[model samples]
Target: MIRAASRRGIRCVFVQGEDVMEQLKELIRYEPGINLEPVPCRCSECNGELRKVEEGEEAILQDKSYVPMAKIGKCDFWVCKTCGRVYWQGSHWRNMRLQLQRLTKSYH
Candidate 1:
């Protein structure tokens, strides 16, 4: 589905004056679903349970500003409690989503 969106060039744009970091943070917030559960620092990719290393750390966004709130980074990917596989916000997220949006728009 994501790849399909990319082929059609569908893109997501933030509202005017909406900071990308804030938007990204909102997207990164947790939502409950069958495959996901709010758990302690656990690596999403490796499935290795994580231990809290820090309460939160600041993240720098592409717009050259820090995210308003502290974000957690995992030492390893799989079980990093801060983020799981289903939803991850990183440097590449925007670019990757833009391409994928095109692929997704085909159905729309």
Candidate 2:
């Protein structure tokens, strides 16, 4: 055990983890649910405002010269106008949206 004396003449005792539970339990409080705010459509990387990709900028979405042949799909996309980062509802982003839905529903 380590011992130390304070200037106020109080004996401060260091208690091990096993001996401190009873004294600490009353000060803890638990809440049953969490509160969440509305999800904003911003850049996941930089949180910058996202703008729709404009005409003639399709090259920014993918490397046209190197991209392999792919099946067709349509998804609404938003890109960060500042950093030029693209955002699309891939599986991970969709999963995060689902989690947000579950949390808001659970809290309500």
Candidate 3:
């Protein structure tokens, strides 16, 4: 799932495959004045931090306006130090969340 991408001065690996597989391969444009930040989280494969991406910059979409958010996954999935892959909620996350809710239900 490690796709090639660069952020700031750090060369990062992004997760590949899934809904928008092609999007993962797309590189984000860095603006000279933009302030980017690295997404701190565990990689789906190896639980590593995703490479830092310059904030304030936008990803140019074909036949559309600039994409403000990094559509890595649902929420933000960071890359891992080992596997160098990104991870986040795919499609079954809602079911997982519901299970958690059920488990954490309080006594009425």
Candidate 4:
């Protein structure tokens, strides 16, 4: 598959992993310089660029239910202009960071 893509002037990577974290590790192993750290620059659901939701601009969200009401004014928010999906660094964000750190240490 990779060879076929290469013939067509495209680059491809074959990643082997049972889950997302493992897949990320494999990607890093394939390319040591790749940045695995989370960045809110793009939407996870779609490849759309994300725009930071400024304070008082929360009303732009089409689906408010995706966000916790209590966190509205407490944390930074990013919205996908194409899909209108909201993103925030909630509790799971810490766990993801920890996992990335472990993955990085294993490689370095």
Identify the leading candidate in terms of TM-score.
Answer: 4
- What lDDT score belongs to each candidate, Candidate 1 first? 0.38, 0.50, 0.38, 0.82
Rank ordering of all candidates by TM-score, starting from the highest: 4, 2, 3, 1
In candidate 2, residue 31 scores what lDDT?
25
Instruction: Tell me the spans in candidate 4 whose CA falls farther than 4 Å from its real position.
Output: 1-18, 61-63
The lowest-lDDT stretch of 10 consecutive residues in candidate 2 is 23-32
How high is each candidate's TM-score? 0.25, 0.47, 0.34, 0.71
lDDT of 1 by residue, 12-106 (tens): 33333376534434333321111222333446466555653333332222122333223335331222444422233544655656644443343
Backbone clash count, each prediction separately: 26, 0, 11, 0
Residue clash pairs of candidate 2: none
Candidate with more favorable, higher lDDT: 2 or 4: 4
In terms of lDDT, which candidate is stronger, 3 or 4? 4
Error of 2 at 23 (Å): 30
Q: List, residue by residue over 70-102, the lDDT tens digit for candidate 3.
A: 463225433345754434444455665554344
lDDT of 3: 0.38
Residue-level lDDT of model 2, residues 1-108, one tens digit each, is 133345566444443345323222211212224222323367768867888656666666664333222411355456786776776556665676666555445545
